[model samples]
Structure formats: C-alpha cells, structure tokens
Target: MSTSNGMRPETPETPDHESWWSRIGTLGQALTALTGLIVTVVPILVATGLPGQDSGNSNFSPTVVPTTSQPYTSPPSTTPPPQAEGINLTVSDQLTDGAEEEVIVITLEGSRVATLHATREQPVVSQRVTATRAGNYSYVVDAVMRWYDETGTEQVTNATGRGSVSIDDGTRLDVYVHEETDGISLSLESATQ
Candidate 1:
C-alpha cells in the first residue's frame, strides 16, 4: 500500500468489516458485563434477600431431620436409702406460771438437732433423729425464757443442760424441762424401746 510519497495512506484498520465487527464486539462486551453482574449480584441476592424482605436461610445453618424417634426414658437414680436405726426424742415443758415464751435448742454431738418453741398453751415438741450407729450420744440443751416484770418491762433468763442418752433401734426417749426453784433443769424422764 504505497502512495505518491512512498508511504501508506492513513486509513482505518479492517475498513471493510468494521461496521459488523464493531457491533459484534459491542455485543461481546455487553455479554461480559452481564456475566460479571450475574457473578456479583446473584450471590449478594442469595445471601441477603430483596431490599424489604427477610433474608433466606444461611448456607451454614444446621437443620435436623429425625429419621427415627423414640420416647425418652430417664435414667434411674443411684443413691441408696438410709439403713441405720433412729430414735424418736420427745421434749415436754413443765413451766407452771413464770414464763410466757421459751425457746429450747438441742444439739447432739456438737450438731444442732432441733429447736423447740414452747408457749404457755402448747409446751411440748418432739423430733425423730436418725443415728448412724448405736451408741450413747451426748447432747446439750440451751433454753431461753421471756416474761414480763411487774412494771410491764420484759424479763429474760437463760439456762443450759448437758446429758447423754443411749439410743437403740426403735427407741423412744422422753426429756423434760421443768422450772426449778433456782432456774430450769433438763432431765431424761423415760425411755421405751
């Protein structure tokens, strides 16, 4: 392609097929853009749903579909029942007219066994205690008495008693608290096996 100056004339490349080729090139570019949009927007649309609607389930969400089901049964407990003998200890109050209220605390072998509240009308309380072994158990009783003085002021007195009793199987023991001439005294009244 030489001209008068011995150089090629300036002209468009592929001049004969430019019109059809450019349209096809444009269509290829459009297809590439549409493919890129699908690749980007389809995942986004699937991850987060449409603008106002709820997002669909996540791919990582776990769904459980049971194939076979049976009624659940609980396991049995392993603890055993107590097998030692016990004693039914009884407390009776013998306060005549000097006290309005009394609180008796009984402790067996340094551990609190029971606390008995005795009033004027009801002056008896009992509790059954289980012994791991058959022997004489030492007990301590602490008593508090409350009454009114002549001037309408309240009066208080405290007394304590210590004793030991033999407890056998199916034994019932009775202890009594009496208002003595000095103060109060706790004594084992009787025991029945």
Candidate 2:
C-alpha cells in the first residue's frame, strides 16, 4: 500500500533499516558522552584523594593514635641462656612384656661427666661426661648380661657383652634398644643413637 508521502508500505519480511538507525542515533551518542564523563570525573576524584594532592592538609592529624599516655613498650628480650661445656646422656627403653621394645637416646656435649638412672613404665639409663680437651673424644657403655630371674630378681650374669654409648658431644649421651627379649642373652637388638 502507498502512504501519504507515496512510500510503499513496510511489511514484516521487509523491515525498515533506517528506522532502527534513527532510534539508536541519539541514544548511542548520549551513552558515549556519559561514558567519557565518568572516565574523566572518576579519575579526577581519585586523584584528588591521592597523597601529595595538596599541602593544605599535609600536617593533618596523624592517622595513628598519638600516645599522650602509654609510649610504645618494647617486647621482652628473647635471648637464650649461655650453654655450659659438658656431655649429658640419656637412654630410654620401650619394654613390652613379650612384645617389641623401643629405645630412645639423647646426648648433649660438654666437659664434666654425670650418670643418671630412671625407671618409669620402662627402665632408663643415662650418663653425662665433661671433655678434658676441646677436641673429639668418645665414651663407652658396656651392656652387662642381665636378666629378670624367675623369682623376679634382677641379676647381671655377664659383664663381657657391651653396647657403646651413643654420644651427643663429649658430654651428652643417649642410646635406645628396640626388641623383645626373655633375658637369656644380651642381644644387639636394635640400637639407635
């Protein structure tokens, strides 16, 4: 059909392309202008808040609290005490009735020797020795043949079997035995330094 201006009638299959462009022309330009304004004004606002923006407020109140009362207190010192020169030894045994035994040994180096014994759920033996010189030295611990008698008496049967003391310096010592034994013989078992 023809219109008043003599243009042919538009149908669904023949859409008016000019009508689409005309609708978006002003809207697109306005959007572009709005985006430019936002970009420019936002950056200026951010810049105004940045450091050294103006010296008028350079001497503003300190952001940190000024201590009119408690000045900053220093933390307590964390220095360790000076260590002495000597060797200390500790031996712990994990003794289970018929099960496995685990031992722990610890040694500390120094100049004087000391012996200590402990009996907890398990038995423990220890020694500490002080070195005469500043050089390397070694110490020994002989595992004497021992057993708990049928009558529950603890007895040392042989003094020949030996187990070396694991040293932690000239002074510290620790030795551990992990094994299950009935006390018939002194087994090397497992010794850990």
Candidate 3:
C-alpha cells in the first residue's frame, strides 16, 4: 500500500537469520531424540536378543550360559580331613612274689573299655582304644593284686591310679603296677607317639 504522497513505504523484511536459527534448534532436538532412542533400544535388543538372530550360538541367547569364570576345578573334596584312628594302651606289672587272680580294669572317659585279667604266668596286657579326635583325656585304673602270705594263706590287696594321657594319632600309653611297702600301687610309666 502506498502512502498519501503516492510513495511506497518500506516494510521490514522477514529475518532470514531467525529462520536459520530456528532450523538449527529443530535439528538439535531431532538429534537428541534420535540419540535417546538408540540408547534405549540397543540394550533391550542385546538383552532380549534381536529378531532372527542365531539360536545355536550361546552368546546370543537370553538365557545366560554361564561361562566358567575360573578354569575347571575338581569338585570340593568329598572325603573329610584325616582323623586319628585309635590309641594303644598297655598295662604292665612288676611283681617278684608269685600272685594269683590279678585283675586290671581300664576306664576311658568314665567308660570301661577293657578288663584285663592275668595270673602269675602273664603280667602284661595291651589293647587298642578308639580316640578319633584330639584333646586331653583322663583315665582311671583299678587293679587287684593277690599273693600268698608267709603262712601260705591267700591275701588280696586293691590298688588304684589316676592319670591323664594326651591322645593323638598313633599314640601309645603305658601304665605300670608295683608292690609298695604297705600295699600295691599303680603308676603311669610312659606315653609314646
């Protein structure tokens, strides 16, 4: 439209620079959306597996085939650690005078494991007692010694001894009995392993 003087007045031209700037903003938004889509879709495709992918390959499967993080190892030892078998116990006596009906009772952990009987002929007794674990073990010994008096009459005497034996694998415990001044007594002679 012309002004009253019949001269065409200037009209502001639409800024081409603003159009360029808006185009750039639109391009940036498009790029951001595309990047977000790639980030979201790639993980899903890798996890659930892509369509038409090879099922024969274990790497492509959704069900995780455990790769041995460590090399093949023998199954954890089924057999337990070695345990002690038993203890060998021997009871020996030194008696000069002839005796009759000699009896020795051996108690382990308050349980009678052996009751050894010997006469003047044999004065030694031995047996194996089970002790599968390790620790201090207390035992008891009861002995009855019999001998003839000067009058040729039968006489009896009772003796007892208390001792502790440290038991391990292949342990041997020895106890001895001897005649004292008043009566008979018992003693722990030695312990060997």
Backbone clashes in model 1, listed as residue pairs: none
Best by TM-score: 3
Candidate 2 Cα lDDT to native: 0.44
TM-score of candidate 1 to 2 decimals: 0.46
lDDT of 3 at 130: 66
Error of 1 at 168 (Å): 2.7
- Measured on C-alpha atoms, candidate 3 has an lDDT of 0.70
Give each model's whole-structure lDDT. Answer: 0.71, 0.44, 0.70
lDDT by residue (tens digit), candidate 2, 1-193? 7999999987657456667556779888789889999998888777567565663556678455549688766669898987766543333333324322223222223222333333344454543344433443343323333446677777553211234333344333333333336433222222332
Clashes of 3: 0
- Where model 2 places Cα greater than 4 Å from the true spot, the runs are 1-112, 120-122, 125-128, 133-136, 143-146, 150-154, 160-172, 176-193
How high a TM-score does candidate 2 get?
A: 0.26
By lDDT, the candidates rank as 1, 3, 2
lDDT of 3 at 153: 95
* TM-score to native of every candidate shown: 0.46, 0.26, 0.47
Per-residue lDDT over 139-185 for candidate 3, one digit per residue giving the tens place of the 0 to 100 score: 88887878898899989888888887676656666657666787666
lDDT of 1 by residue, 117-156 (tens): 7787886656666656667888887888888988989999
**Residue 180 shift from truth in candidate 1, angstroms:** 6.6
